[model samples]
Target: MKKMSLLKVDKLTVQFGGIKALTAIDFEMEEKEILAIIGPNGAGKTTLFNCVSGVYHPTSGEILFDGESLLGLSPEPVATQVIPRDRHAEFFCSLGMIAGTAERIAVNLRLFQRTEVSELFEPFGKGQKGSSAMPHKRNPILAENITGLARTVRSYVSPALEDMVLWHERDISHSSVERMIAPDATSLCEFLLYRLAKVIAGVEVDEARIRANMEITQGLVFSEAVLLALVRSGQPRQKAYEAVQRCAMAARSGQGTFFDLLSRDPLISELLPPRELDQLFDLNHHLRHVPTILDRVLHKE
Candidate 1:
């Protein structure tokens, strides 16, 4: 038995002024079969789909379904037969803006997390504390507030996804959902950006605390430097890695400082002397290229 195509488009053409959006496009779909049309931007892909789906009338075409001409038919049937999908460009665009704002806020929040309030530009108000019972407490309340609000903004995406499953020709299911989520999501994102800007502008960075925290690891953070130094000093990579790993683990478990362990190790001492080891642990050695990286990022050169 021979089966006939369920839907067919033959010699479809579309033109807008002098622009021929689609030309001589032809395709067919059988029952329970899927078809995909792919093309670069502005290459008439949307035009062909629109014409076949009844969103746009083609200049010359024959669209048939079940052996009947579908040309010049009302759009309501076509729209119902084919699924109606919302592009939601505006909602997605707002989401992107919100994500970017949230990312910036997260960076600022992390800065506050790593710093002490005493080192802030302006410390907490007189007698202000995080807990009612503890008078010496200080919290990053502003950053926490932004984090909470960002969660609310992110949650709106769920309802947006739910809105995609509407009944034929579109229904009122997504209407109320959009009405609630769109304004709330956009406004919340704007509020977060504004509040984040204010927080960042007023927050003071504690350089002293930053420096102290950087040294809290007792030089274990420089294990990579030691490994590279060993490699550069003609030690086999596996041997150097095992040597650095032992030191790092010992330092992490409060056994000894990384510098002391490496300096005492016979293998490491043979290649890198005390002076060379000292040079490797220097913070400036790691941050020496920061200025160049900053210039490239900020100056875009």
Candidate 2:
């Protein structure tokens, strides 16, 4: 027996007027997995997606989905964007009811104020009002403007409805809109899943990057440990507080470390030596009762 990937794209290529969009691209995705395609602008991210989703037949190469070739099949059938009014709205509302009812019973109380809850059902609003001084203003900061643009590009439904009323040049009336949606939606869907796959896998965090971020935090990372140690020692609370503050300032200025500042302070040096102070910052410190916690959680007494 052999394991196989759910989707494999091999040597996919696309060209427009000698401008090579994708050249010899190869990638694969396994079952129950997500993938992401990322690249800089003009790097064929969308073009490759179009090829995979059946929108643009690759100038060359093979696309295998579930071990079957998807080439030549219309991408339109593969992706359908809809705002199914009755069915979709009913389904979403029903889901909300189920979740809402469960939550209400769990809390044994009515949650949220009446006015606050009404906002979700309000009619969708659009546009921004410009200043009264400018009557010709047409501000474009509309709610869901991006969403509307996305819908227009990949999920528009109005053209099909409007076409039903068309008489002559009826074919041209709908053909233009269909052409855009068919390829655009298909490519967008492909790009979406490709991008999602990378997220699911968790982009590899370069150890170098993590180390760089850690450096920026400076010695402030040890603040809690220092604060707790000050509380634990027999020193009066206010005096210990001021000493730690001075140490932090010196550390931030790159003058000395937290321990160095503490060492110079005659009071702390006499009371707490270096060896004991080291214990406070040790990384291995844990919650002390791991087994007891796990036993309660897993029900394995």
* lDDT of all predictions: 0.78, 0.57
Q: What is the lDDT of candidate 2?
A: 0.57
Off by over 4 Å in 2: 1-200, 216-218, 284-301
Candidate 1 TM-score, true structure as reference: 0.61
Error of 2 at 286 (Å): 7.8
Supply the global lDDT for candidate 1. Answer: 0.78
Tell me the tens digit of each residue's lDDT in model 1 across 1-301: 7666899899989989998998888898998789988878999888887887778998997899988887887655435543454456446556855765776666566555643423443234566676688655567666666777787887788777777787665678878887898888888888877777777677777788777766788887889999999999999999999999988888889988889999888899899999999999898899999999989998995
lDDT of 2 at 100: 37
Tens digit of lDDT per residue, candidate 2, span 1-301? 7767799999988989888999999999997789988889999999998787666888889999989999977433322342222333343344334433333332221111122221111121245354367754432222223223334333344444454443442335555655765555445444434433332243222345444554565646666676667778877778887877888888889887776777788877777778866765553343456778888888965
Candidate 1's C-alpha runs over 4 A off are: 1-86, 93-97, 100-133, 249-256, 296-301
**C-alpha lDDT of residue 146 in model 2:** 26
